[model samples]
Target chain A: MNAVIVENIIKTYGKKKEVTALNDISFDVSQGELFGIIGPDGAGKTSLFRILTTLLLADSGKAMVDGYDVVKDYKAIRKRVGYMPGRFSLYPDLSVEENLNFFATIFNTSIKENYDLIKHIYVQIEPFKDRKAGKLSGGMKQKLALSCALIHRPSVLFLDEPTTGVDAVSRKEFWEMLKTLKEQGITILVSTPYMDEAGLCDRVALIQNGKILSINTPRGIVDSFSKPLWAVKSSRMLPLLKELLQEDFVEDAYPFGEFHHVVMKDQSDEPLLRQFIEDHNNDSAVLQAARPDIEDCFIALMKN
Target chain B: MRTLKFILRKEFRQIFRDPGILRVILIMPAIQLLILPWAADYEIKNIKLAVVDHDHSEYSRQLINKVTSSGYFILTHYSSSYEQALEEIEKDDADLVLQIPDHFEKDLVRENEARLFMALNAINGTKANLGGAYLRTIIQDYNRQVRTEWIQFPRFSSETQIEITSSNWFNPLMNYKYFMVPGILVILLTMVGSNLAAINIVKEKEIGTIEQINVTPIKKFHFVLGKLLPFWILGLVVLTIGLTIARLAYGIIPAGSFLTIYVFAAVYLLAVLGLGLLISTYSVNQQQAMLLSFFLMMIFILLGGLYTSIDSMPEWAKWITRFNPVSYFIEVMRMVVLKGSSLADIKYHLLKMAGFAVVFNGWAIFSYHKRS
Candidate 1:
C-alpha cells in the first residue's frame, strides 16, 4: 500500500470563503520513497501536511495514511506516522533530553527502544543534552526536533520545510540525514520553498495558489522544459533587464541573483538577443545558453 | 494513565524549572494571606471627631468627657462654634461633627429627652454609617448612666426593663481577620489554580509546541488531565501554605476537621481548574487567556461572598452564587473553620461541588479538540 494516499482534497478558510487554502489537491507517496512537495510561500503545503497528519480536516476529500482513513482511523494513523510541523514546535523551556523523552513516553515507548533509529542524530546534540531547546542553535534545534518526531520509529515521517532557515552547510547535512533515513525504509514526505532542494527528491509536485502545477521525477520535470533559456549578465544588470523584457523575441526575463534568466521565443534568436542588449547597453554584456533546472521548469510551468 | 504521567511530569518540570513561576506558585499566596487580611479588616475604628458644644453647662462638659473617653473617637477639634467644627470637616480633619445643642442637660432632666445633631462626611458610606452607629450606641449608654445617677427616684420599675444579653458565636471576639482569612485563602487558591491552568495550554499554543503534542496518540481527556493535575497539585500546596500562614501569622486554625477542609478543597480545585482549562481552550493566545481569566476571577471573587455575606445579597445575586464554585468553597471553608461544621453538616455543599467538578471538567474535556 502507498504510505500516503490523498484524493481530491479541498480546504478553504473564513466564513465568507475569501481564501481557498487548498484546492482539489491530490498526490500519493510511495512506501520508503522520498517525495517532495515544492512550492513558494503560501502554496498550501502546510495545509496539506496538516490534513494528512490528521491535525486538520479537508473540506471535501479523503486521505489515508498507513492503510488507515485519516478521519475514521485517526488514532491508528497517529500511532503509525510522525509529523514535524513547518515550525520548530518543541517545548522551549524543556531541555533537549526532556523533550525527546516526553515525546517517546507519550507514545508508550522509551528513548532506549528507539535508540537505534535516532541515535545518529541524537548523538550529535547529546553533549548539550541538558540545554533547553530554545537555547540550541537553529541546526541543533532542527536535529532535536527531527529526533523527537522519530522517537516512536514511525513508518512514515512528514517534515514541513525542515531546512527553511538553517545555514547552507546545515541544510546540506539535514538532507544527508534524510537520505540516511530513507535508506532505512521510512517513507519521507518533505515540503520546501527552496527550488534547488527539489532536485534532491525522488519525485516532486510543484504547487501554487493551492493547486498542483505538476508532479514528476526531478529529472522528468527538468527535461520537459522545452523553452530555450539563457543566463544574461551586463555591467548594468538593472537596465539590461528592462531592455530584455521590451524585446519581442525575449519571452521572459526575471532577475536571478547575479544573472537575469532570459527565455527566448526561438533558440536561433539568442545571437539577436545578445546583440540587442549590447546595442542598448552601449557595451560590455554577456549571454550564454543555460540548461533548465527545476526552477526554470517551475517558472515555465507557472507561466503556462 | 502512562500518557498522563509523562504529560504531568513534563508540566511539572517546566513549572519548577522556571524560578519566577515557582515563586508565584509557592510564595505569593503566603504573602497575600499574611498581609491581605489586615488590609481587608471590616471592624470600623478610630472615628475622627469634632465636638461642637454651644451649651457650657456641667452636663455638656461631662458629655464632652464621655465622648472623648469612648476610645472609638478622637477629639480632633473641641470647638465652641458649629462653624469651627464644620471647618475641621471641610479640611478633612474630622469624619463627624458632634454638635451638642443648648439646654442639652435641662431638657433631659425636666422633660426626659434631649437632642444631638450629627453632621457626618459620608464620602465613604460604610465607614460613616458604622461610625454613626458606634456614636449612637455610646450616647445611649451615657444617657442611661446619667438618668440613674441624677434621678433619686426610679425612672421605671425594674420589672418593666428587658435586658437583652447576646453572644457572638463562632468568632467570639468578632475578629475580622478570622472572618477574612478563610475567604482570602479561597481567593488565593482560586487565583493560583484558575490563572495557572488558564495559561498552560495557551502558552503552549503561543510557543508553537502544542502542535507537536496534538499529533501524538494522547487522548483529549488525558491532555486536559495533564494540563490540570500539575496546577491542581500546586494549588493544593498554595492552600496548605495559606492555611499555615493563617495559623502562624494570623493565629487561625480550623475549628472543624482539617480532613474536611482538604476534602472540600480537593473537589473545589477540580471545578476551578476545569474552568481555567476551559478558558485556555477558548483563548487563542496567552494574553487573551490572561485577560479572560482575570475577568472571570473578578466576577467569581466579588460574587463569592468573601467581603459581602450571601444572606445580605439580593435574591438574584444569591441565585448566581449557587452556581459559583468559589462561593461554595468559601462558605465551606468558613463553615468548617469558624463554625466547626462537620462533614455531614456540609454534605450539601460537597455534593454541589462534586457536581460542579463533573460538569466543568466534562465540558472542558469535550470542548478541547486535538484535531482543530
Candidate 2:
C-alpha cells in the first residue's frame, strides 16, 4: 500500500568532497496517507521532494512514486504526481486564473475539467482570479498554488514545506485543504519545519543532518519516549537551566517555549530532584511532571 | 505543440501585462528610428582640420577655403610651421593635418605640380579612410582649376555618341535609413525581449518560485518556452511597427514581400528568445541577468552592423560576426528591402539564422541544471 518508496537515496554537491545533501535516506508513504517529513531548514527535505518529483537526479538510490521509478519512469511519474515547492512558485506576473490555467495547460488539462476537486480552495480566490498572482495575499497565493498543483488530478502530491511562511490561520486552512485532498484518495507527502503541525500528519518522520531519526505515528513517537519530563520555570528561568545542566541527575535540559523541559538520568527514581531545587533560595518556583510531545521524542532520539 | 502554444500565450500575456516591458519593446525602436539618423550618419560632418600654410600666400589660403567649403572638414587651428602642425596632429586636437610646402604658389606654376600632405588619424579607420579620400579629391580638383588652360582637350570635335544607362542595385540613391531601420528593428527587439524575459525568469529564481516550478508537473521546456513566447510576439509587433515606420513615416519602402519579413522575424524572434532563456538560465537574480543580457546584446547589436557595416569590419571580427545570427537577419532584411531579393538570394543568411536558433535553444535547455 506504499504510494512512494525512496530507497538509499544519496545526493551530493560540489567537486571536492562537498556537501552530501541527502545521505542514503530511505522512506515510504502509504496510499491515502498524510505523511510529514519533519525537519528544520536544510535537512534534506527539499532534496528528497525534488528527487521524488523527478526534477532532480539522485546520486545513488531508487525511488518509486505510485509504482513508477523516479528515474527510469520519470516521464510516467511526472504525469501522476503533483509537486508544490516551499516557495510561492506560481507565476507572479500572470493573473491568478492565468497562473492556474498555464499550469493546467502544461499538463494538457483544463481548469474546468478539475474545477470540482479544487472548487473549495479555488473559490476562495475566485474574486481575484483576474488579479496578478504577485498582487495576491500570502494565503491567497498558497491557495492558488495548491489548486494549480492539484489541477492535473495526480495520484500522489508532493508539497515541500508548503506552509513554512504562511500565517497561523492560513497554515490551519492549508492543512485542512490537504485533508480534503486526502479524502479524494490522493497520497499527500508534505515536509515542514513546524513541530506543532507534526501532530496533524497521520504519520511523521523526524529528520536531521540528512538522516531520518525516527518515523512513526505522532502519538506513538511521543508515547514511546521512556524519559520522565519535568517543566521547570522560575523568576530566573535561563540561569536555572544552566544550573540544572551542571547537575549529575539531570540528563538533558532544553527550553521549550516559556519553560525548560528537563529529564533525569536515573529512571529508577526522581533521584533527589526536589532537594536540589529546595537548596536554591527559590520562592514561587514551579516544577511539575509534564506530558512529552513529538519534539521531546525527537530530542531523545537525536541524543542517541 | 499544444504546450508550446500555451507557453507562448502565457509569455505574451506576461509581457503585455508588464507595461514597463511593453514600453521597452516598442518605444525604444521608435525613438531609435527617429533620433538615430542625426548622430548615426556615415557622411562625416564634424571633421577637425589643422592647416600649416608655409607660403602664407593667397593661393594657399584659397586651398584652405576649398577644404572648409566642402562642408565636411571643421577648420579649428592655423599652424605657422610644419612642426606646429605636427604637434597639433600628435596632441589629438586634430583629426587631419593639411600641410602646404614652402613656396607652394611659386612651386605649382614653376614645377607644374605641387604636393600637398594630409595626415589622417587612422584609429577610427573608417572615418580616417573616408575623410582622407574626400580631402585628396577636393585638393586635386583645386589643382585642375589652377591649370585649366594648360590641360585643355581637343576642342569641340564631333565624337561618336553612345547612350548607356547603368542600373543601380538595392537602393539607387543608397538611403542610409533603409539600411538602418531594419537592422535597428532587430536590435531593438533583441534588447527589450532578451533583457525583459531574462530578468523576469531570474526574478522568480531569486524570489523562490523556481522551486515551485521544479516541483510542479510542468516540464522544464514548457516552463522556459512559456516564459519566452510572450516576448517573442511582442518583438514581432514592435518589428512590424518599425517596418511600417520605415515605409510610411520614413519613406523607405520594402522592395520584398511583407510575409517574407514576418516569417523570417518569427525564426529570428525564437533565436533571440532562446538567447534570453539562456541568459536567465545562468543567472539566479534579475540584476545578474540584466547585466549579462545587456553585455551579450551589446555584442549582438555591434556585430549586427547597425552603426557600421559588418562587411567592413576586420577579417577576424568578420569571422566572429558570421556566428552572430542578428548580423545575418539584419543583413537579409536590408538585402530584401533594398534589392528585392528572393528566397534564394538570402539562402546563406537564412540557413545561418536557423543554425543559431537551434544552437541557442540547445544552450537554453542544457543550462537548466541545478546550479542556476
Candidate 3:
C-alpha cells in the first residue's frame, strides 16, 4: 500500500473566490519513496501539506496517510505520521535538549528509545544543548527540527521546505540526511521552490498555479524536452536577448546565470541560432549547445 | 492523561524560564494588593461646605461648629447671604450649601418646629448623599440636646422616650478597607488568570508552534486542560499571596473557613481560564488576544460589582451582571470573608459559579477547532 494518497483535492479562499490555492490535485507516494513537490511561492505546496497532515480541511477531496483517512482516522494518522511545517515551529525560548525531550515525551516515548534515528543530526547540535533554540544558527535549528520530527520513529515524514533558508553546504548536507532517512524505509514527502533540489528526489511533481504540471523523475523530465535548446551569450547580454526574441524561429529565451538559455523551433538547427546571435552582436559573443535540465523542463511546462 | 501531563510540564517549563512573565505572575499581584485597596476606598471625607447663617443666633453658630467638628466636612465658606453660598456651589468650590432661615430658634421655640434648607452639588451623587446624611444626623443630635435643656416641663420628664441603639455587624467600625480588600483581590485574581490564559495559546500560534502540536495525536480536551491547569495553579498561588498581603497590610482575615474560599476560587478559575482560552482560540495573534481579553475584562469588572453595588445598578445592567462570572466570585469572597458566612450561606453562589465553570469550559472546548 502507498504511504500517502491524495485524490482530487480542491481548496479555495476569499469570500468572492479571489484565490484558488489548490485545484484538482492528486498524487501518490509509495512506501519508503522520496517524493518531491516542486513549485514556487503561491503554488499551493503548503496548502497541500496542511491538508494531508490534517491541519486544514480541503474544500473537496480525500486524503490518506499511513493507510488511515485524513478526516475519519485523524487520531490514528497523527500517531504514525511526522510533520515539520514550512517554518521552524518549535519553542524558541526552550533549550535544544528541552525541546527534543518535550516532543519525545508528548509522543509517549523517550530520547533513548529512538536515539539511533537522530544520532547523526543530534551530535552536531549536542554541544549547544544548553542554549535556547532561538539563539542557534539556521543550520543548527534545521538539524534540531529534523531530529525532533524523527525522534518519534514515524512511518511517514512530511517536511515542508526544510532547507529554504539554510546555506548551500547545509542544504547539501540536509538532502544527504533525507536520503539516509529514505534508506531506513521511511517514506518522505518534501516540497521546495528550488529546482536543483528536485534532482535529489527519486521522483518530482512540478506544480504551478495550484495545478500539477507534470510528475516524473528529474532525468525523465529533462529528457522529455522536445525543443532544440542552446546557451547564447554576448558582450551585451541584454541586447542579445532582445535580438534573439525578434527572430522567427526563436520560441523562448531566458537568462540563466552567465548565459541565456535559448529554445528555438523544432526544425531550427543550432548552427543557424549561433550564426544569428554572432551577426547581431559584438565579436565577444559566444554560443554553445547544451543539454536541458529540470529548470528548463519546469519553465517549458509552465509555458505550455 | 499522559499527554496532558506532558503538556502541563511543557507549559510550566516555558512559564518559569521567562523571567518577565514569572515576575508578573508572582510578584505583581502582591504590590497591587497592597496599593489598590487604599486607592479604591469609598469613604467620603473632607467634603467642602458653605454655610449661610442668616439668623446669626447662638443656635446657628453652634450648628456651624458642630458640622465642621464632625470630621466629614471642611468649612470652605461662611457667607451671610444664601445667594453667595449658592455661588460657591456653582463655582465648584463647595459641595454643599447650608441655609439657616431667619429667626430659626424663635420659630422653633414658638411653634415647636422649624425648617432648614440645604443645597447639595449632586453631580457626584454618592458624596453628596453621604454628606447630606451626615449633616442631618448632626442636626438631629443638636435638636435633641436643645430640647432637653430648654424645655423644663415636669410632665415631659415623666413621659417615655424611645431610644434606639444599633450595632453594625461584621464590620463594627465601618472600615472601607475591609469592604474593598476582598473585592480587589477578586479582580487581581481574575485579571491575572484571564490575561495569562488568553495570551498563552495565541503566543504559540504567533510563534507557529501550534501547528506542530495540532498535527500530533494529543486530544483537544487534553490540550485545553494543559493550557488551563498551569494558570489555574498559578492563580491559586497569586490568591494565596494576595490574602497574605491583605492580612499583613490591611488586617483582613476571612471570617469564614479557608476551605470555602478555595472551593469557590477553584471553580472561579476554571470559568475564568476557560473564558481566556476561548478568547485565544478565536484570536489570530497575541496582540489581538490581549486586546480582546482587555475589552471583555473591562466589561466584566465594571459590571461585576467590584466598585459598585449590583442592587444599585439599572435593570438592564443587573441582568448582564447575573451572567458575569466575576460577580458571583466577588459575592462569594464578600460573603465568606466579610460576613463570615458558612458554606450553607453561599450555597446559591457556589452553584452559580459551578454552572459558569461548566458552561464556559464547554463552550471553549466546543469552539476550539482541532482540524481547521
Candidate 4:
C-alpha cells in the first residue's frame, strides 16, 4: 500500500469567497520512497504538508496517511508519521536532549528505544546535547530538528523545506540524512523551492501557483522537455531577454542568472535560427545552445 | 498523564533556568505582598497639626496636652496669629488645625454653648475620614472629661452606652498578612502560569519552533495540553512556596486543610492556564503575550477583590465579579483562611470555579486554531 494517498485535496482560507490555497491537489507517496514537491514560495507545499500531517483540514478532499484516514485516524497516523515544518519549531529554552525527550515522550515512546534510528544524526551534536536548542547554530539546529523528527522511528517522514536558510554544508548534510532515513525503510516527502534539490529525490512534482505541473522521475521529466533550449547572453545581456521574447520564432523567455534560457517554436533547423538572428542584427549579443533542467521544465510549465 | 508530568518538568526547567522569566513572575508579587502591605495602611496614625489657642486659658493648655499626648496628632507649632496658621496650612505640612476663639470657656459657661473649630485636608480621603472620626472621638472624650471635672453634678463616668463588640471570625487578630498572602498566591499563580505557558507557545511561534509540534503525531489537544500542563504545575509550585512563606514568616497557616487549598490551587491553576492558552491563541509574539498577560492580571486583581471587598460594590459591579474566576478563588481563599470555611461551606465557590474552568478551557480550545 502507498504510504500516503491524497486525492483532490482542496484547502481554502476564510469562509466567504475564500482564498483557494490548494485546488484539486492530489498525489501519492510510495512506501520508503523519497518524494519531493518542488515549487517557489507560496506554491501550497506547506499547506499540503499540514493537511497530510493532520494539523490542518482540507476543504473538499480525502487523504490517507500510512493506511489511516487523515481526518478520522489522525491519532494513529500521528503515532506513525513525523513532520518537520518549513520553519524550525523546536523549543528554544530546552536543551537539545530535552527537546528530543519531550517529543519522544509526547509520542508515547522513549529515546532509548529509538536511539539506533537517530544515532547517526544525534551523535554529531551529542557533546552539545546540554546546550539550549535556541543557542545552536543553524546547522546544528537543522540536525537536532531532524533527530527529533526521527526519534520515534516513524514510518513516514514529512520535511517542509528542511534546508531553507542554511549553509551549503548543512543543506548537504540534511539531504544525506534524508538518504539515510530512506535506507531504513521510511517514506519521505520533502518539499523545497530549490530546483537543484529536486534531482536528489526519487521523483519530484514541479508545482507553481498552487498546482502541480509535472510529476515524474528527475531524469524522466528532464528528458520529456521536447523543446530545443539555448542560453542567450551577450554584452547587452540585460535587454537581450526583452528583445528575444518579441521575436516570432521565440516561444518563451526568462532570465536565468547570467543567461536567458530560451525556447523556440516551429523551427526545425538550428542554423536557420542563427540566420534569423543574424538577419535581425542581434549582433551585440551571443547565443549558445543548452539543455533544459528542472528549472526549464518549471519555466515552460509556468508559461503554459 | 505522563505527558503532563513531562511537560511540567520541562516548564520548571525553563522557569528556574531563565532569570528574566523567573523575575517577571515572582518579583512583582513578592514586592506587592511583602513590601506594599507594610508600607500601606488605611488606618492613619501620624497627623501634623496647627493649633491656634485664643483662650490661652488652662482649658486650652489642657486640651492641647490631651491632643499631644494622644499620639495621633503632633503639635507642629503654636501659631499666635490665624494668618500664620493659614500659611502653615497652605504650606501643606499640617493635615489638621484647631482654632479656639477668645474666652472659649466663658461662652461655654455663660451661653451654655461652646465650639472648637477644626479644619482638615480631605485629599487623602480614606485617611482623612479616619483622622476626622478619630479627632471627633478624642474631642468627645475630652468633653466628657470636662463634664466630670468641671460639672461635678452629672458624673461622666456613670453613663448608659452600648458597645457593639466585633469578634473577628477565623483570623481573630485580623493580620493583614494573613488576608493578603493567600490572595497574593492566586495572583502569583496566574502571572507565572499564564505567562509561562503563553510565552512557551508564543516563543515557538516566534522562533518558528511550534511548527515542529504542529507536524508531529501529537494531537492538537495533546500539544496544547502538553504545553499547558507544565506551566500549570509550575504555578502550583510557586503557590507552594508562597504558602510556605505565609506559614513560616507570618504564621498564617490555612485554617482550612493544606490538602484542600492545594487541590483548590491545582484546579484553579488549570483555569488560569486555560486563560493563558486563550491569551496565547490571541497573541502572536512574546511581547504581546507578556503585555496581554499583564493586562489580564491587572483586571483580575482589581476585579478579584483581593485589596478591597467587592460586596460593597453596586449590584451591577457585583454581578460582573461573578464572571471573574479570580474573584471566586480570592473569596474562597479568604473564606478558607479567615472563616475556616470547609469544602462544604465553599461548595458554591468550587462550583463557580469549575464553571470557570469549563468556560475558560472551552474558550481556549475554541480560540485555538489548527490552521489560518
Top-DockQ candidate index: 1
> Least lDDT summed over 10 consecutive residues: which range in candidate 4 chain B?
B34-43
Q: Which 10 residues in a row give candidate 3 chain A its minimum summed lDDT?
A: A266-275
Question: Candidate 1, clashing residue pairs?
Answer: none
- By TM-score, rank the candidates, best first: 1, 3, 2, 4
Candidate 2 lDDT by residue in tens digits, A25-60: 988899999999999888899888888988788889
Q: Give the per-residue lDDT digits (tens) of candidate 1, residues A8-74.
A: 9999999987899999988988899999999999999999999989999989999999899999999
Where does the lowest 10-residue lDDT sum fall in candidate 2 chain A? A267-276
Cα distance off (Å), candidate 4, residue B198: 4.3
Between the candidate structures 2 and 4, which one is better when assessed by DockQ?
4
Best by TM-score: 1
Residue pairs with colliding backbones in model 4 are A78-B217, A88-B208, A89-B208, A89-B209, A90-B209, B8-B230
User: In angstroms, how far off is B176's CA in candidate 4?
Assistant: 3.8
Kindly list the per-residue Cα lDDT of model 3 for residues B44-129, writing each as its tens digit: 89899999888988888888898899999999998789889988989999999999999998888888888999899999999899
**TM-score of candidate 2 to 2 decimals:** 0.88
Residue B182 C-alpha lDDT in model 3: 89
Name the regions of candidate 3 deviating beyond 4 angstroms.
A15-18, A267-279, B52-59, B78-91, B99-117, B143-149, B153-165
Residue-wise C-alpha lDDT for candidate 4, range B228-294, written one tens digit per residue: 7667766776777777777776778778877678777788888888888888888899999989999
Better of 3 and 4 by TM-score: 3
Provide TM-scores for the models: 0.96, 0.88, 0.93, 0.86
